[model samples]
Target: MTAATTAAPVGHDTAPTGHDLAEVGRSPATLRTFLHGLPGVDQVGADQRAAMLATRSIKTTAKAWAIDLAIRMVDLTTLEGADTPGKVRALGAKARRPDPTDAGCPPVAAVCVYPAMVPVAAEALAGSGVHLASVATAFPAGQAPLDVKLADTRAAVAAGADEIDMVISRGAFLAGRYHEVYDEIVAVKQTCGDAHLKVILETGELASYDNVRRASWLAMLAGADFIKTSTGKVPVAATLPVTLIMLEAVRDFHAVTGRRIGVKPAGGIRTTKDAIRYLVLVNETAGDGWLTPDLFRFGASSLLNDLLMQRAKLATGAYSGPDYVTLD
Candidate 1:
């Protein structure tokens, strides 16, 4: 949990340990065999682990630290059809100065928006120190052709996005076209250039924990800087069990390849308590190394104000309401 003032350069390699060099240039069949061979997940054990971690409590000093850390790790996202330049600008201002009354409060990690809104978001966040991220590759659906998806990714990068959150072709993955999903991520990574790439698995649609584990490996093996849980548009977004699986994948991925990949649990996480629970999961499961904003993030919008209100309570010894904070 470094200070929010620390600079977060896009595509910065946080883990220098290194990955399996041999796995880097393998054929599609070889890679698939390697990923599938990686042990299967025991759903019951994973669920118990997640449930047990969620009950860990924090209070007083630890509570305050978790609140601030959660604030700094937020993506502060706003992805909707009605998004406007004014809305994006307002969101950026909020990200830079989350609490107008309390300058000590840390700003959010980044601002996430649709590809069409990248220019507006980039301009709004120009000198704010908060990075701009765009969702490309047809976003929530990811049903477009490879060329269209690549073009969509390039457009976001050209518009000054520091991070690109691309959705994997779930249809291909489910259809056993693992190579197609892997190649798409590889191509998108090249298109990203200096920008960091986050591959979203959309776990709910994937159907099983085994598929989730396999998808996690597929994205990381193909060079995804971050492996995310969902797009927030699906029936089920980020859940404790699903997130736990991704965290385990990253931990094991680092153990096998010695490379560190970030994990983001987006959507449905709107409360300060829920955010802290996820922090506990990260601390216990992935170890404290992933506790920083760079290696972990919450892709959420409403969660920001809740955290601010909790921070205010810690300082003033009183609870606040929506009227006390901006509605962005």
Candidate 2:
């Protein structure tokens, strides 16, 4: 089967229209019907197709282009509890110039940090063209109350974060309290004001591919500018099969709404080959429109080092040792 042939059409009974879009989350019953009506994922097929695409290769000049493109798509992230201002500043510097010795190296797409560190990141990335993203709404776990989550988001934006990554309440979503989840996303987006809102589904805990699809559509319906895969704190962060499912969701959503939404696969993407596989997946599944940094991003810290080493290999015909690239 072709790359585009990943899943069946979203069930006809709930296929979204302008009116359907307007009515999506009006009530719990309405949200459940629409989400449950989405077509079931062909799990075996998804795994096989992702494996097939991974076998496809880019060589020489095309490989170089893919490496650079992947570099630009990376959200150079540092979200550790042990994180310090000095460490954040170092990450900001890396975001501005991924490879200090190479002038041709393109800067990363953004730098993501906790809400408290947003001000530090904002200062370090000042006027550098790289976006400042903060994880708020009680990131990773997302166990806070609605008012607390809103306050968390407000503080990040007020601190100069241009992008806010908020986590969905997985407990509510799992208990079929989708309206609660929807209301929370809407509230967070409102708090974001001009900043872009990326809704994290934390798919690892969602339990199944069908749940992943349902969560993806639910987040989009609630006004997520981007649907993110994981928070990098999960054991199953960012797999190719999961990312493919999200790509297909965004593809179908755009077909209905004529509005494009981005996809971000955070965590466990640490190699040049891994990044290229995701890029190819985007190209094949979502078409070229999603290939740019505006629509796709890899939330990673060490992935940049591998891409830079591979880029140097292509340019100099020799592998640059790990010593050449700074460790994040």
Cα distance off (Å), candidate 1, residue 125: 0.9
Best model per lDDT: 2
Q: TM-score for candidate 1, please give it.
A: 0.93
Mark the regions of model 2 whose C-alpha exceeds 4 Å error after superposition: 1-14
The C-alpha lDDT values of all candidates are 0.87, 0.91
Q: After superposition, how far is residue 72 of candidate 2 from its true place, in Å?
A: 0.7
**Poorest lDDT segment (10 consecutive residues) of candidate 2:** 1-10
lDDT tens digits by residue: candidate 1, 128-226: 889899999999899999999999999999999989999999988998888888899999999999999999999989998889888988899889999
lDDT, model 2 = 0.91
lDDT against true structure, model 1 = 0.87
